[model samples]
Target: MKKTAKSLLALLALMLFSLSVSASAFAFNDIQKDPGKSYIEQLQKKGLVRGDGSGMFKPKSAITAQSAVTLIVNGFGLNIDNIRFIKEPKASDYFTKVKDNAPYAKAFIIAQLNGLDIPRDIDPNGKVTREQYAHWVYQAISKKGEYAWIEMYMTFKDEDKVTKGYMDSVQKLLIGKIASLDEKNRFRPKDAITRSEAAVILAKGITFVKNTKPVPQPEQPASPLTNVRMSSEAYGTEALKVTISAEAPHAGYGIEIANVAYKDKQAIITYRVVKPDPDRMYPQVITTVAAAVYISTAYTPVLGGEVQP
Candidate 1:
């Protein structure tokens, strides 16, 4: 009996191991020869995308607007987690065509809230053009954080065909090497972007954001404020608590640590004042407010970043 039980246990373990490997290594049968096969596979393996029901990825098919939005939103991990909604937001609130109960409706909402340039009356089922895809991908990358890019313009044979609003995104992608023009040196801006092409662009954008760091922006004139102060103290043994305090005209005005950049053994902190809600009322009285953050002991805290009005 013991010998029989051991054999059954070994068989079950082997089956589980095989299942795990198969799940991770899953690939679409039709994408083997596609130029973006590897990129598609990368996304599929990470659960950011999937093949059609029959194990085939129609690489040549034009991707719809909703699908494009869903992929970019998931691939870049965009979310509205930090946003406090007064009521449950729905797709109907922001878009005219997206159905509230549709599978991709939530993604559209997240994309819009994250600052993607989605039109209010966009047709979710309509095909997404290459220029549109490029713009959204670029905007999604921006939401991750600001990264330095070379200042240059890329000229293409069909530059005139590119929409004015999308020109900057195309140039930035080309400059970053996240995207490239065809052998004929033309970007078919109006062409409906294929699934394979979309996959490749998304994969490149994801990689770019993963390996890049936010660069500090050029200095700007500090906003005039009253009684601003900053200080740092030891937090436990390995961390430092950095704090910033400022006087506000009323309780409704507040301050927050907007960003932190670590460079040259210095933890540069940027802060912004939070504006009070327009619809809410607060006492009209002088107030002192503060915001704090903990950083590693290895770096010294320094006040940085332009204060926003």
Candidate 2:
């Protein structure tokens, strides 16, 4: 019986550890198979986001401008440079809603100090749309620089549908791989941003700020890869196809390409060995590269591609 008790205690400890780890990933009630789960957990781990104290993240719930600004301020580490004031600015001075003891009071001040274009009469609890959040986050990162239009092709079918004054904001984010299209190749800029999606955008936005240089950068040596092509199409939903041809051909079974992310306005593709193909030992090994299809607007089905390596 003593041995059994010891075994039970060890099992209990292991279970507790697993629960703690899972809790760290998300104490939320939802988001088990959520694509945004990793991003949300990342921000939560960094202490830039949080669930209700009772342990519910409300992942699908709409986020507010009030909370979004706070997340931007905290997640991007913008509060490091304190804004001076002739007088200690009260929340009322900047926002009509936020009181000194209000939950969003400090965030409003940080947004003000950081020069966030928050109007005094703005509704604090209004649900923030994708375009609205994009504009604000873009400003926070750029330190309110005049957004330059890169003169890139607008591929999203509904690019014109973006709310006024937010097209450049969305485009800037798209160029940086922070904001992305829906599977329908639509920006859906006017849609309310869910907490889950907000987490992903904010995390990526913050990373972009940290990595960008203040000055123009010289180009790096191009990869040995060639004929890198990207295309967008709709299956049941929209999909992005990234085709990369290698300098030389690779084995059909061994060559695999992955990590189709956006970089420098190109579909950044990564290749890795999934496993060895000992069975395909033909007379000779031929070099070839594989094309990967990331399905969905955010990521989805592959548009057909051919890689001639």
Candidate 3:
């Protein structure tokens, strides 16, 4: 009985040893010398990435659109947890090519709801170019939070190859060091990104989000209408000039005459507050801003609904 028990104990020990080795084994067979090995490993550990059924990452393989969107949604921890729905959302509601039963469909739905610029008919299995991935990942980052971006344009060798709409996103990624150019100072915007390269860029974006703080926007004081006055004067015409004035906290805030409506013998002048230009500087003192619109002297001038309060 003692000898039989000893044999069973030995067998159990061997089995335990094998399980331990399996758990410690590398997740993929092809990532050993890949440039993005470390990042792939990090993502694997976080459950943000996985290898093929054959235990190969295929680092040089092109990343598909579905896979890219899934990674961005998962890597950035985006979800619809906070949003309540009367009806459960489905991928088909937002995308045409994505099937409701597809594994990555939910990710696509989340991406669309978050405003990632995905087309309605995007193919899930289609390969994405470097600029395309960059644009999507940049949109994800923006949805996460707003960060202070340096006000400078980054010139690349293939600058002209970039899509006009994606220019700002590419510039932002380059400026933040989340992505870089090749030795030739080329972004290779049109080239399809490999799995390894995508992992590296995504990992960098995740790290940036984790470590960076969002810049808070300062609140502007309300623009209150101080007065609206009318006078008659224009180039050799019997016109009535209606001046709409308001008190603004800074010179940057100004009022503009949006529309003039004639009703019941009254010239109603509608005005709207023009927000301060983001790229311009202004003095931070109380200032009176005004706008004038000339109308025929046939009707009395009155302020529109917008100028009130």
Candidate 1 global TM-score: 0.69
Query: What does candidate 2 score on TM?
Result: 0.59
Which ten-residue region of model 1 has the weakest summed lDDT? 81-90
Worst 10 residues of 2 by lDDT: 299-308
lDDT of 2 by residue, 1-309 (tens): 999999999999999999998776566656667789889878877988888876678888999878888898888666624322213455775566777788878888778756576766777788988888888888787873343446675679887778768877788888878888888888888889999889989989877766665555465544434443343445455554434344333443343564555421224345543334567644444455554555444532222223233
Could you estimate the TM-score for every candidate? 0.69, 0.59, 0.66
lDDT for model 2 comes to: 0.68
Error of 1 at 265 (Å): 45
TM-score of 3: 0.66
Error of 1 at 262 (Å): 35
Q: After superposition, which runs of candidate 1 have C-alpha atoms over 4 Å from their true positions?
A: 1-25, 217-307
Off by over 4 Å in 3: 1-16, 24-26, 217-309
